[model samples]
Target chain A: MLDLSTIREGDSLPTVVKPPISRSTLALFAGGSGDHNPIHIDIDYAKQAGFDDVFAHGMLSMAYLGQLLTNWAPQQALRSYSVRFRAITHIGDEISCSGRVSEVFQENDEPRVRIELTAANQNGDVKLIGEAVIAVY
Target chain B: MIDRSNIGKSFPPYAVEVENHQLRLFAKAIGETNEVYTDEKAAAAQGYSALPAPPTFGFSLSLSKPNVFEAYEALGIDLSRLLHGEQKFDYIAPIHVGDVITLHEKITDIFEKPEKRLEFIVIQTSLVNQHNEHVGEMTNTLVIKN
Candidate 1:
């Protein structure tokens, strides 16, 4: 559980930087997530679709953001999580996931905290922006 | 153009059983090292009766239904041109391994941006466990390039 007493607005969660995305990782994610979209794994299909190469799935980044939250608190503590895909994450891009406490409030008499989250590549290009609410003790 | 008339259309409810190996594979694919997602003992330590599904695992469950792409086909969406625009999940309860989850899905909205030559489809799903408890809800927006 997240310790509400020890948290303050604006406090940052530890950042998680993943190794550069690789084709095998993308292939593995395709099977893992059951998203077999050719744009994400088949390079020839990607070229046929007007892209020069395959890109990472948006859900992959969202999953990384989920990992960031779970790293701070247990999974059951998560109340809600949402994300908007801002840009395509291409292969070879290293993703850095980060979050910060955005608000502290009570819902249904239970203390909760809202976190603003982000996933960006090594070049600092933001790929996804998201928010998560978690119950705090 | 997507048929706006499909908005509010509900699909047949489908059920999927949660499995431990699936969770482990998903955890590995996402590079998750959290034992709570992979080990029953660690999950018990966290007060879970069984291994807990990772936060985004529900998305995979929602797709587990046979003919998962039929909805898009009915919506006139060419899978080749589709992109995931956004996703949201509201957790009412934790989903655990061995739970049978039933999903109810519907088309909530459809719209187009002529200026960008883009079309958007919003689908909402409600998840209920075998015990008839609401466990989670998901909203998925898919964007199609014109």
Candidate 2:
């Protein structure tokens, strides 16, 4: 649990590194998310779509960022979260989800934290950029 | 060009039950070792009624709607050329396992940037629990390359 009393602007969140994605990971995600797009599961179809190989679903990476946020704070604290997919995540890419407190202020007499989030691969290529707002005590 | 006439149109609302096993699978897929996400006993110890749906779990629930592709087909979009551009979630309350949440989705907007060779179709979705309370709203932007 996050200690709202001690959190400060510019404080960095603990980084969460994901295991290297494999074909089975995407298939499991597809089963869970119900996103059975062939480009994500079929290498032949992905190549037909002019890609080198199958790619990870963008929402999967976003979910990793969500994991990062919820780990730091309670689920009830999350007010808003948004992410823009920046680049494709290939099947073997390892994503690292990280964030930092950008600002803290009062909204309607309640404390709120605005955080900037990023999911990047081992090669230092960013896959998604996002921002999240949460209500804190 | 996307069929702009579909803007403001809403799809049929559907209900999804948040299941613990699916939540555990998702947590595992994300490499989340947090017991509260996968263990009911741990979650109860943490003061939650049940294993809470991991953040973004709503996306999975929302997409599970059977009529999902019908929304894109309405706009004359070819599934092959579709790409996810962005996604946003507004969490108003905690959604837990066994909650029967209903998902309502609509085609909110459509725009194009000819110079960039892209067209965007934005869909806004809302989730309400059986209690008639708002759980969250999701904005999903899909891009079509020219």
Q: Model 2 residue A127 lDDT? A: 96
Which CAPRI tier for candidate 1? Answer: high
lDDT of 1 by residue, A62-89 (tens): 9999999999998788999999999999
Q: Estimate, for each residue in A1-137, the C-alpha lDDT of model 2 and write its tens digit.
A: 56679999999999989989999999998887778888999989988888889999999999889889877887778889999999999988999999999999888788899999999999999999999998887
List where candidate 2 sits over 4 angstroms from the true fold.
none
> How far off is residue A6 in model 1, in Å?
1.6
lDDT of 2 by residue, B14-121 (tens): 999988788877877777788888888988987889899877888888777776777677678877778999999988888899899999988899999999899999
DockQ of each: 0.84, 0.77
User: Clash pairs of candidate 1?
Assistant: none
DockQ measured for candidate 2: 0.77
Query: After best superposition, candidate 1 residue A96: deviation in angstroms?
Result: 0.2
**Residue A47, candidate 2: alpha-carbon lDDT:** 87
Off by over 4 Å in 1: none
